[model samples]
Target: MIAVALVTGTLLFSPVLATHQVEVRGTAVLSTEEVIEAAQVPLGVPLTRLPRATISERISALAPVADVRFGQSLPHTLIITVTERTMVYQVADRGSFHWVDGEGVDFHQTAEQADGLLGVLDISNERLLRDVATVVTSLGPEVVTMTTKVTADSIDHIVLTLSDGRQINWGSAEKSAEKAAVLPTLLGMKAAWIDVSVPSHPAIK
Candidate 1:
């Protein structure tokens, strides 16, 4: 068999045998349908002709897909596997809610109800929202569990609403670990809001 590279940055396969056989496969953390569709592979085509690198790039375009592996499965079969990131919070737009990954790329099916997921809103800055999403992803599960909504202000601060109707003051993405460390203790106290913006002294009011 002879393989030729195309100027369009794709691969081309010429049959050198009585039968042309190829297999491809990959794993997707959440779903593989999107990955296969993005590859734009025809129903009947040689596997070698498919651009593996280009296909991987297309799969990576998806927000949830963290890592994608593409390879041949057996004969005349293409397979794709994708690893998705964890869901930190669900951001709502208009009436639909979409799941935001750690990278703040919004994807996934929309939900009508808020459910147990935290809601992020009123973000004045895109960078801050992205940083907050990263912080939410890094914090322990309890942080996610306790948080209901995250609102961003011009002061580069985050205002969080807990499930218990208690508000929290999170200064910024910096020192999120330290703030998270005092979460259990703070939740134990009785107050309408907890201010953890100051690393040294976190107050409740």
Candidate 2:
């Protein structure tokens, strides 16, 4: 009975189990204070009683956080690890531009244009954005650096405009690996336009 009481007392009031520190990791664009504020972690609470799900839900509400992980550093600290989303594409909307990640989530808007991101023209549909993302991600680094913009009026009519005034009819996002494999060879040809939508029957003009 005495041991049971001691255990209960320790569980309820032990300073060793209280959270005294918070460590945020993997933050680049987001500040530590921002993550902490979003998490709203209950400091001084017992580490075991910390509501991890609630903390995660709060942090996940932040636009830049793609994923997050939580851990308790025994005796006094809580650790938050974050994976931020990559800004892969930019789409013009209402005179401002919005940045989208590979997951097709439009996370932020900027007044100034960002360099080195694929400019998506005439597209606002989320599904089409996802398809564009798939195509962009599938390209090799060599091809990606030469490309400037992507446009798709419909899922079946995707196009890539290169920096050097060349065009590629990339069709739908399907069979991307096959398309990517044949693109370099097509680029080597003396053509103004290359069509690899049906990679099985590539055409050059």
- lDDT (CA) per prediction: 0.66, 0.87
RMSD of each: 5.9, 2.9
Worst 10 residues of 2 by lDDT: 115-124
Q: Pick the candidate with the highest TM-score.
A: 2
lDDT of 1 by residue, 20-106 (tens): 332334443444455657656554556666667887787778766778776565455666656776667776667777766777766
Model 1 residue 168 lDDT score: 83
Query: What are the runs in model 1 whose C-alpha is more than 4 Å off?
Result: 1-33, 42-49, 109-111, 122-125
